[model samples]
Target: MRTFEYRLRPTKAQEQALMRTLLASRKMYNACLEDLITHYKETGKYLHLYEQDKHHGKEAHPDLPAVLVDTTLKRLHRSFTNFFRGLKEGRKIGFPRFKGATAWNTIQFRDAANCLDNGRFKAPLQCGGRMRVIVHRPLEGTFKFARIVLRPSGWYLQCVCETPPHPLLKKENAVGLDMGIRYLVADSNGHIIDNPKHARKTAKRLAHAQRNLARCKKGSHRRKKAKKKVARLHEHIANQRKDTLHKASRSYVDGYQTIAVEDLQVSNMVRNHCLAFVIADASWGMFRQYLEAKAESAGRQVIAVRPHYTSQTCSQCGESVEKSLSVRTHVCPFCGYIADRDENAARNILQRGLQVLARTGPSSSRREGPEQSGESPSVLKREAAGL
Candidate 1:
């Protein structure tokens, strides 16, 4: 299934209705949580969603759509399921907390027919009518479901549809990627994609807005306005980062038949206090996810190679050279090879990926060292140069 999201332009009345829907949904969720806790504690048994949903019409706002209530109950059930699943797996789990009025951002319609039709989208309470949807592209396949989400910027509609995959493209080029905070990505071809550092770039504006928010009196109109300003800045940063990622991933998928990247555990890496913020801002994991998803659609390969020693090992000669994080260049004394540290890692990643493909017959996605290829250093250089 593929999903599409479009910004929604709603009338002032429609906006009010959407806001009320969100508030009602949040209230119902908190009530359901309370009921579940009380039921379980009293009876020593689970209170399922069906039982909670049965009392919806009597307890919930009479005007609220049934779909909204059903979806909210389903969400509560899923949250509980995840909480138990995490506990069972020995992971730290927090009990679900009550959602604040402003915290609830999304309300989904389980049935597509309720909200969407040809050139028209309507909601309950006589608030909605024909909307001016900016159809950036044609939406394909059967619509499955639609959701109304409120962001710091504005409201949007996300629709999920079942789409048949296109025939795979015919391409033979492959490359390796090394992700870094300094540069967004370094490829095997010695090309460096600069990191935009969207959050860092917009830090001053965000800080100013946050400071204004702090100075405003709580529950005052000024504070609400200030809060929205802060949210807008955050939304801007997110949009900028997402745009950059989409462009970079599109290039990789369109240019290469196969792409290899280091299997870096970003979750573990973030534990280091010094670089935690930068690492999170870099969004290396998000980039890799986009790569894999796009590659799948383009009929390409995305391989994850073991990250160990990729930075220290010589790409020209099969020898290890120990270097600290401070070292920006790989100076291999054994073969007199000198290159940017990340570029060297990228080359090694490419060679290792090729070795994996040769051994596993181009279908392997697992991390395993197989026999090295017969290609020489000159051949790799030529390939990188597009010779």
Candidate 2:
């Protein structure tokens, strides 16, 4: 399956209709949540959608529009299903909540009939008067569904389509990558992609915009304008970061068949206040996601090795040396080898990743840890660790 996104344009009247639909949805969402809470309080269990529907079906109210009520009830049902699923998966239960005034501004529809082509797919919403689609890239298969999304700057529609998988070449050579704050990534082949600090460069502008926004009175026209300016700045930063990740990951996928990387827990890394901005700017997790998707499409392999000793252990000597964040150079006492810390770490990661691949085989190549096939060494290790 492939997805394509296009910008959307709607007339003033159409935009008003869309807003009304979203308002109805939001009102319904809040009503359902209140109903659930009331039911749970009285009966010790939440009311199901069928029960709620039956109760509301008998009610006659001047304030409630039929369309709004129906939309709200359906949304309530989805919320309940999602809540139950999350509980089953040992995730925190999510309860539906009311949308604030600003929240309703970002409402969108998914899988609308008009957006789909022939019962097969929905058309892309275009800007201007005519329904136009600029083919940014050629697609291979039948389109299935299109989703409308409201962004801070404008609206966008994404179409999901199905296409036959094409054959992609698999090279024999492999490379390992080490991600760091100083350098974005260091490869086993002694190549380093320097950290651009794109976010940091734009931080002052973002800060200024935010400060200006904060000074504006709430609900005032000035506040709204300031808020939009801030949003635009954030959107710009996000786009730049996304572009950088795409370019960097695409280069790696195209150059090597086997890609190895350290399985760093990004959530934990972000806990450090000093490193949070840098970590967010790096977008290591997103980079890994892109690598996986591209690698899968290209029939390439991605291996993730435990990050535990990659930085401390010498790639050539297998000896551990103490190092600090301030230490940019890796000086191995055992072998007297000197190199950039990230470069040394990348080489170590490559060696360890290759060792894992040799032991577990290609099917267990994911860097996210191990396959659940009950045979991968990393999986077994994770099981032993109670992961």
Candidate 3:
């Protein structure tokens, strides 16, 4: 399923109704949590999820839509499931906490075939009228469900639809992408996109707004306004980064039939204090997410090869050559191969991806390694796959 977002323009009364809906949903969620704890502790048994909805749902808070109440209960159920799973697996777990006014800012609606039609939302309130919606681009496929989210800027409606695939013509083009700090992407095709460093560019303004927020008295109007200002600045940076990544991922999906990229261990990489700031700014994980989603829709393939010695091995003859981060140029002492460091890595990634395809075709999505072993993700794959 694909999702489309639109801006909602509600009249004063309609806006008030929406706010009430949001508040009721939040309260309903918290009430469900309280009941879950009480029921679990009292009888050590799981309560019927929908049965409790009769007490805390529309019967108790009639202002909220029934669909909204149902969705809220499901959210609580999912959280409890995850919490229990974490405990079973011996992982860190935190019990779901009650959300405050600011934290609870979304209300979801289902069975809304009429909720978004002809660029208008049929008002959910008893007062019947249509709410203006800015449909910047026409939505595709059948409307499934929608969620109205409150942000620092304004209210937004996220509409999920069952979109059909729009596949491109078959082609044989393939490229490998090496993610880096200096450049956001370096491809096997010898192309590069520079990292814009969105957060670093707006650092001064963010710091100033944060300072103002800290100086204001607690729970004062000025402090709230300052907090919003800081939030807007952050939102701006995020929007910029998202836009760039979308464009880059779209360009690749349109041009290449197959895309290869290293399965980077970003969580492990960020442990170094010196490079943490820049690495977070790169947002490699976000880029990969966009790549995979777009690729799936476009009927293209994306292969994630292990990233062990891609930068150290010679792409030409597969000779292992040790190198440090300071070395920007890769000089292969064995094969006399010479290329830019990231470019060589990209080439190596492409080679590994092809080998994987030869072994298992283009349908493998698991990380290129065994489930558990005393080996790194890369070396294990290489030794097992004989690559």
Candidate 4:
């Protein structure tokens, strides 16, 4: 499934209806969350989705469409599912919270069949009229659902569609990636993508907007305008980051047949006080996500190798060479080999990924610890003691 988003040109009445629908969905979400908390506290058991739906009955929301209401309830249920799944996987995750009006900005329609499409689409709501859509590109396959998202700039319509899979392209080139704070990505071939630092670059503008917002009185028109300015700056920064990542990842996927990258635990990595902000700004997680998605569609392979010792171990000699973060160049003590630290790490990652592919084949290859599947017992023991 793929999603295509377009800017919506809603009429004044349509805009009001959309806002009302979003507000109604937020209230419903809060109500369901409250029900769960009350039920859990009173009975010491969670209120499941179906049970909650029964309580809501067959009554339709005043201004919201039935499809929107149902979809919102289902989304709330999915949040619980994810929260519980995270707990089961020994991950620290917060429980679902009641959403305020500001928090809930999206309203979805589960069924695309109900929507009437001509030049514009008519949504199912009492006040919802036909809204003009800007289709920048043609949508493929069957439309599964639609979601209306309210952003700082304007409203957007996101259409989810099920697309047919095409045959994968065959290629001979394989590359590895090393993500860093200074550079966005360093490939095995020594190509480095400089980090754009979108947020840092726009820091002054954001700071000024924030200061303006702080000076304005709460609940005043000036405050609302100031808040919008701050939000728009943030949105711009996010868009810039996303666009840069997409281009970088797309280039790799298009050029390489096989791609190797570190299986970084970004959530855990962010706990380090010194590098947390830098790591978050790099957006390594999103880059990996984009790479994987592109690789999947292109019939390429992405190998997530163990990150441990990749930077410390010499790619030329396969010997451990201790280094600190400040050391940009890698110098191997055993073989007198030298290279950029990130480049060396990328080479090691590529070697490890190739070995993994040879052992398990590309189809079965996945993220795993070297000790669990590769590396002899003696090697593991030696590495444990830094022998």
TM-score list, all predictions: 0.84, 0.78, 0.86, 0.89
All candidates in order of TM-score, best leading: 4, 3, 1, 2
What ranking emerges by lDDT with the best candidate at the front?
Answer: 4, 3, 1, 2
lDDT of 2 by residue, 243-315 (tens): 8788899999889878998775553432333433454434777888888878877778888777776777888
Per-residue lDDT over 82-123 for candidate 4, one digit per residue giving the tens place of the 0 to 100 score: 899989987777799888767888877778754437647667
Give the per-residue lDDT of model 1 (tens digit) for 161-193: 888756366788889998765677899899998
Candidate 2 RMSD to the correct structure:
6.6
Q: After superposition, how far is residue 289 of candidate 3 from its true place, in Å?
A: 1.9
Q: Deviation in angstroms for 213 in model 2?
A: 2.3
C-alpha RMSD of each candidate structure in angstroms: 6.9, 6.6, 5.2, 5.2
Indicate whether candidate 1 or candidate 4 has the larger lDDT.
Answer: 4
Whole-model alpha-carbon lDDT for candidate 3: 0.77
Report lDDT per candidate.
0.75, 0.67, 0.77, 0.78
Off by over 4 Å in 1: 57-61, 89-94, 126-132, 197-200, 211-222, 268-282, 364-387
Which scores greater on TM-score, model 3 or model 4? 4
Q: Would you list the clashing residue pairs of candidate 1?
A: none
